[model samples]
Target: MANFISNAFMIPNDLIDKGYMKKMKGSALPCYVLIVRNTRGWNKTTDSMSISQFVEQTGYNKDTVLKGLNTLEELGVIAKKSSKNRASEYTLTDSIIAVDFLDSEKLDSEILDSENGSGSEKLDSKMGSGVENLDKLLSKNSTHNNNIKTNTKTKGNFSEEFEIFWNAYPTCKRKSDKSGTFKTFEKYTRVISLEKLIAILNAFKMDSQWIKNDGEYIPAPSAWLNKKHWENDFWLKAAGLVEQQPQSAETPEYANPQRRHIPTMPKRFKGMNA
Candidate 1:
């Protein structure tokens, strides 16, 4: 029985007849196919797509998708135009590229002759370059991700820090949102240094607002962090007092007019400047 496909789209015979397939040896082939599907499959002359969309559809990384698109552009297989803050618009040069897994092998003389020496060597070289490029992309991506991982504390370490903070918070009438509080703790510490945040937490330990009636009115840790209570003055002083501005050393004169001294007319006003 012959191979058959029912749910299909058309692929331009020129795609094979003109030998564009041979030049699109590596990442470019799949990228072109993706474009074909989006444009020709949808029965539209043009469609917009992004690197992310190609990555998702083809399961290729960003670099691979970019390389494929570049190759297709260079080959004049597609026309791509950038749209600001949107996916690039793509126009497939070929009109009928949607075929049901058709035997492209039978249609191409070079592919049919691929079993012979010269054709086989070219295919190998083309595939070799593809693999090499893919490896390089993966290596670079891994290195970048590793560098970020080095600076970031692991989840286990973060959880430990959160446990310490949770223990130090004042016990209230009822606690809530332990999991959510952990999340807020991460964000809170990002803006307010953990050292200062902890200091504020400790200061609020004996705060009248937090401790009145045995911590009855104290908010949950998540709520407190969300409200940014660490910015409150209650945490800055020994007795939950608002910090006071330093007073000037100069003495303030009494405001009472009764205390004013009457100079005896400056001793007759110096006799008119005698």
Candidate 2:
């Protein structure tokens, strides 16, 4: 249901000059394949798209489009589900090639450290001043830390079942509903503009190399977008899109009595204007 456009949808003109079409085997890149990829961007999610919708959006013949969809499925780049009554939707099968799902080792250590003071403790410490509730949730249930299991093959590659994280929350705010916390594990889509995204990444000190898939670039998930407001605002101001607000006496933590610095009076005070 979320907004998405697949990178595969864009068919570059160079594909023609490079003989990519002639070299493509098995019907040599069908018309619908071109149409569908064009209609969808690399970052689009498929839980909402129907075949009829695709046809309508791409202006491709139903049969031809279906054939191309099947071809893409066979290529193992997309997975299709069959339904008894409603039309099936497609999901990208390119997760491992794109997002770097956090490894179990990292998750385990981070969870444990946050609870009992171990791996990413510093990050938790920073959050403690502003987000005490989050600190409590993260540090609670000490017993859960003992179950440390590591998976060699899983290298933190998120499962297909975890796709909801990308579209579930806004990049700047984390909220909750009746379902509980919104933490999700999934590959991120890289649909947001590169400039905005890179600034977010730089704020979190996360490497952007994960977006490279199969020697090509792909869309990343919104999760990779850092949630720090001031950091993002700094970058936004630098881009000339908005003005950055300077830190003032009214700043949250800095304004507190515990953080305020005592002023040193001068030995000789200047008289007020006579």
Candidate 3:
């Protein structure tokens, strides 16, 4: 009892002594092992083995497994028997071992049912283990994919907030780098609240420098966020009306001084008088 191998199916020593493993190498070896597992593994003389079952056990195509089964029968290593609607039944023969060595039993068809035809619960035990493991693996992957989607959704929500800043600020040119701008917006919001930033931006909309030249002096959206020039009393530093507006058609003041105007000093020098 102590010497019996735990969790092992029995194969007779003559199988090795006769070199069936090397002889049956590629296709037949796995087929033989699988039959041995379901039969002698459960103290039974025979098992009902299906071609699809053979494909699963050996990882070979249907034709390959059928050919191997034929070769195994020719070698007298196993005998096959089948009924009209049942899976094929196989028994190890004298050439390998179990035929002459093991006790033969007249097992009933089934108390429930079985592919081994041994009338025991052994077959489901093996199949249930495989199904249980597959279910567990699928569950873990589902949870992992859900976690990735959640983080992506959160990042998308942050970008939606940036659109507010993008729309209110007008520029001379179309927005070319909105992704880069949103990244800078994220960084900027850490320094100042969105409410405060929006207030400053709204004030700039009416500033003399921004109004004049049709916002030509205003930086593009990406540059504006990176330069952070909108900070530190930007609203208080609006340029007052100028007398020397540019004499260009694009400048509204060229058509009418009351429309808009700009001084000789740039926006940086505003309110810094000597």
Candidate 4:
């Protein structure tokens, strides 16, 4: 059987030529292209895709798909939001916007050059104008580069802090919700410090109840942050402090045989007593 192509998708030349595609490895480009194709238009920055869909569309294994997504995310090419019961939603980051800006600048410069080349006399007259345009382009490019640097720095700081919290947390389940957890952390920054949060997480991580059954009772990171469970007394209870009741004196000896002490009969009466 032969398959016919009924639809075509557009990919930006700059995405490849500008070194973005080269920076990615394995299936990242294919996955990114599929996402861009499924999006409504060039300006649309977000698209939803599940792992299964990526595997089916790109003919890539699940691990490859995951690696591609992780690379894209780490490179700041995309941001993801995941939830307990929903597929991850991905949004193209500012890198795409920068590419668009550069492309437009290049187009404008080409146009200006073409117009000036129509006549030598015109070119001579517009040489100063061309120089001014060139200067402006350089200035704009410099500003764009600065903005990228700032964004990268901010992302790096966030990842560092989030990594600390992730490592301190007891459970590894629902780790895909890290983006959501980071958002929560940002929201609560004024209410609590990251150091304090990490300390509290460490306390919970050592808690008998939290670590019981291999952290089966520990909440997901997103859930813990969302519920502000760090402020709760679960850690104290797990430490065997709170929620523990004292044994009553009236408690039956049979109920706690370890605490029971029975008197021994005298040796002389041992055999004579019934």
Any idea what lDDT model 3 has? 0.61
For candidate 3, the per-residue lDDT at 84 reads 69
Candidate 4 per-residue C-alpha lDDT over 1-274 given as tens digits, one digit per residue, 9 for 90 to 100: 1452213334556676767888789999887876665442223446545565576568798999999988888878678888653446788654543444334545556557767674455444455455556445545434222123355545333443454465445545556666677777778777866655655565666668776787777777877777765466775454333457787989787786785578998676346555
lDDT of 3 by residue, 1-274 (tens): 5665434565667677767777775678889888876665544557765565576557798888988888889888899998764567898764454322222232223433555566456544544554565445434434222123455544333342465466556656646666677888888777865545555565666678778987877776777667665554544243211134456757665456674465576556558567
Q: List lDDT for all candidates, in order.
A: 0.62, 0.41, 0.61, 0.61
Pairs clashing within candidate 3:
none
Which regions of candidate 1 fall more than 4 Å away from where they truly are? 1-6, 95-274
Predicted structure with the largest lDDT when compared to the true one: 1
Q: What is the lDDT of candidate 4?
A: 0.61
- Model 4 per-residue lDDT at 12: 50
Please report how far candidate 2 places residue 177 from its true position, in Å.
Answer: 33
Predicted structure 4, TM vs. truth: 0.34
Off by over 4 Å in 4: 1-8, 41-43, 100-274
List the lowest-lDDT window of 10 residues for candidate 4.
140-149
- Each model's TM-score? 0.34, 0.25, 0.34, 0.34
TM-score-best of 2 and 3: 3
